[model samples]
Target chain A: MTATSFHFGEGDRTLYGVYHAPSVRRRRPLAVLLLNPFGEEAIRSYRVQKIIAERLAALGAAVLRFDYYGAGDSAGECVETSIDGMQTDILTAHEELIDLSNIRRVAWCGLGLAVPVALSAFSSANVNLAKFLGWDPVISGSEYIDDLTASHAKYLADALDMPERRIRRELSMQLTEVMGFGVSESLISDVVDLELNGSDLDVCDDVALIGRKSSGAFRKLHGQLTSTASSVSIEFDESVTWNSHQALNSIIVPNDSIAAIVRALADGDE
Target chain B: MNERIVQFGDDGRLSGVWNTQRKNSNRPTILLTNAGIIHRIGAHRLNVKLARRLADIGFDSLRFDLSGLGESAPAAGALGYERQSAQDISAAADFLEENGRSDSVIGIGMCSGADNFQRAALADHRLSGLVLLDPHAFPALGAAIENMINRYLDPYRWARKFSELKLNAKTLSLRTVRSKSEFSEYGGDTDEQGRLRPPKAEFGNELRTLTKRGVEIGIFYTAYVQREITRATQFFQTFSDYQLEGKVTVNVNPRVTHTYTTLQSQNMLLTEIETWLKQRFTD
Candidate 1:
């Protein structure tokens, strides 16, 4: 399989990610356009996205993984990016993926914060979506932001090897940064107001919402979405959150989850 | 800095961000690669700062991914991953030239990236310069002793060192904790991906070739690499066969971690790199 990288959009914005083209010939050319998490979570889950994309491509699907606008290799700065803009980017990526691969059918999948964007895109998608896969999707922005803050606090406390009070004091006194990404009040407000369940999301033929047992919010969101959609399936995996400090670096290939999703796609094909 | 996404290479598989000034000059385009798994934004947006700084001084820069690393696709065969990385660097340079961005190109990167581009610069005359960050080197005996004294002498550093030396107590190796964990250039148990650096003999030969070809080189080392190379002058002594008198600039810093995680460390690094560019390439 060969992974290609390129940019396409208004004025050709600079975005970074790999396009994993299947080496083996497929009966039908099905493309997968992956969406990444927002901010530091985006950095954490990058390896996971690539690994998932590679696995999907090996299953005879063309996968294109990219950084959203104002993030990573994209043309602008991180603070410049928004949830709405990211949703548009997803739509744009979907169109670009189809054109690039020359494949009519495509799937939209994302991890963490990417789930909200994927949901928004799927709901408003002009073209029919083959599948919408969410791997430990974020159900509420309020919860997500809190998690971000807590994570940042923990990271800072651990990084400086200081007490929680000292870390809190430092954050309050100084412009607190999460990892390398500087967090802004407006950005936090925007994210907090977002709720995945509140969004107008449409269900496709195959909707596989997979998460770990420990992922309460995602699992609950998955159950609710699947129950209401009249179409969806359930799958379980090792509940390790790559967004945390422990599991970010190591590449834990979701072999079983990949097989499950592949099976579902194959079933959809039949 | 004005930025553009450039897709140039075999089948347009390679992607890069070309940061240039609106008003052009006779400056070279700097090509940057991922320091291991870290993307074009760099470990802590180091590449972004460096690129913008170069543009401020009328020079353009391109930060990109090597094949199978970061955003770029993997090579068909994993056996020649290092060879492919060299080719990727050359292709990025070719893209800049073909687009009329710049005829001269300088390759800059950290750790594995530094080693890979160093190899490329040794072979490709098109790359007129190299800014290597934390490329591996042997530590000299004298410098090792001096470093030990410096570490023991400083109270803050001394405390940190002594804290880690507590055998029974749970202690994190600063090497494994701060800069590494996630962004460690070389990770995992297996050598399946292959080594980023060339053998010692080949590296010496390449350094000689680079000097002979008149490529200006800037080699920067952080605390970790300082531990590896020991002395700043050891680079000269080890590569003494090559006429490195005016050809190479070496700075070994023990103040920063490998990835320059802190704002202060990152600022220091940018200052060092920008100063080097001004002296070597910028007119």
Candidate 2:
């Protein structure tokens, strides 16, 4: 697999992306667009994304992984990141994947926070998606916000060795940043409004949701997708933790998860 | 500021973003490397901010990922990571010089990036200045005393220390908490990802050589878990015989985390580095 890094998008909103070209040409060209999660999760999950892209490329699927305008090595600041912007980024990336690969069949694998963006984009995008895969999908936006808040508090307390009272005091202030990355209020409001339901999954022909382990959110999302989706598959891999302090700094290569994703993307490949 | 994506180095495997001033100038290019495994964007997009900041001050900066990290493809060779990193830094410098950007380069980084910056400076003469954040430091007498005093002054530390002492007494362990020598300079070293640290004396000699060679050095140490630099002047005081008075500048802040998790801390670092650059290089 050969990976090439470049910037793609319109003026002022140019985004950074890495295109992973397959080693050999397949009978029917297939491409996978990997959408990253929000803020700190994107940083933590970057290696796994790269690994999955490489693995998919090895199996003859061209993979394109990118950062939104306001994130990663892209052209904008973190404060500019929003749900609508990210949904647009997903569309832009999807178009880039098709243009770069010139392949009609393109599948998208959204990780964590990207799950909702991918689902939302599935309904609005002009191009037809071959399949949609969501890893550790966030079913409830309000609950995910709570999780982020709690995680940020825990990280601050543990990192600084602060008391619970001090932690509470720190969190009581207006939160413009989480962990280390800055987040916009508008983005927070947009994320808080997101709730995965059967409506979003109705447009997707093939939907697969994978999680580290089966949780309430997973079962709920799976049920919703199964109820309305044309075809749905759910799987679990317990090798990785996406939002833990212990796993944040480490470059995790969840072998089982990678294998599962590759199998899903290459299901119809010869 | 004008930003352009660059793919240089052998086989065009290296990837970086070049941020430059709108008007061309003969200023030294700043090369920012990867902070550990995080991409060229640095921790919390610090590198991107720093690059643009330098550009605002009429300086060009290239923040790139070393081989096998970020967008850079892994080299098909058996070279160790350290040597490969140094080579990559040299290659970045070469890219800048070849593009008629600048002949001299200022290397800036934090944590693992700082370590690599220092290592690359030793082998690459194109590096005119280095801004190191939380680089490797040997335990010094003053640092230990200052650390103890600071801990004693903390109200919560006493209770924590007492609990630790009680646990130690119950375990009957002679092992006192000390930074492990074999672990990485920043700690969390495992068999699969162990960090190689050079001896203090050897590192001191390297610093002496850099000072004699007239390389501008700014070493900033933060409250890292594995940091032994508890005092601001610990680097100079530890190697007092090296006479690094005019050659190096050291700043240690125990309140700041290794990655500068807060916005204020990030600003503090950027201001310190910017001030140091202005003072050292008036060109």
Best by DockQ: 2
Per-residue lDDT over B1-283 for candidate 2, one digit per residue giving the tens place of the 0 to 100 score: 2788889999888999988664554778889988888888887778988988777667789999999888888877867988999999999999988888767899998878988988898999888898988677777777677767878788886776676687657443322222254344653322101334567777777788887888899988776732367666667778888778667888878777778887788888888888888887655
Question: What would the per-residue lDDT of candidate 1 be over residues A1-270, giving only the tens digit for each residue?
Answer: 777666666765556556788747653568888888887677667777777776677768888888787777666666566777788788888878887788878887777888876777666666788777777677788887667666666664444433546555665565445555655567666777878762234566667776776667666666676555545646575555566655444455455665555556545431
Model 2: fraction of the reference interface contacts it also forms: 0.37
Model 2, position B3: C-alpha lDDT score? 81
Q: Compared with the true structure, what per-residue lDDT tens digits does model 2 show for residues A142-161? A: 88887887777776655565
Clashes in model 1: which pairs? Answer: A14-A74, B68-B73, B68-B74
Candidate 2 TM-score to native: 0.90
What DockQ does each candidate score versus the true complex, computed on alpha carbons? 0.15, 0.48
Error of 1 at A12 (Å): 8.3
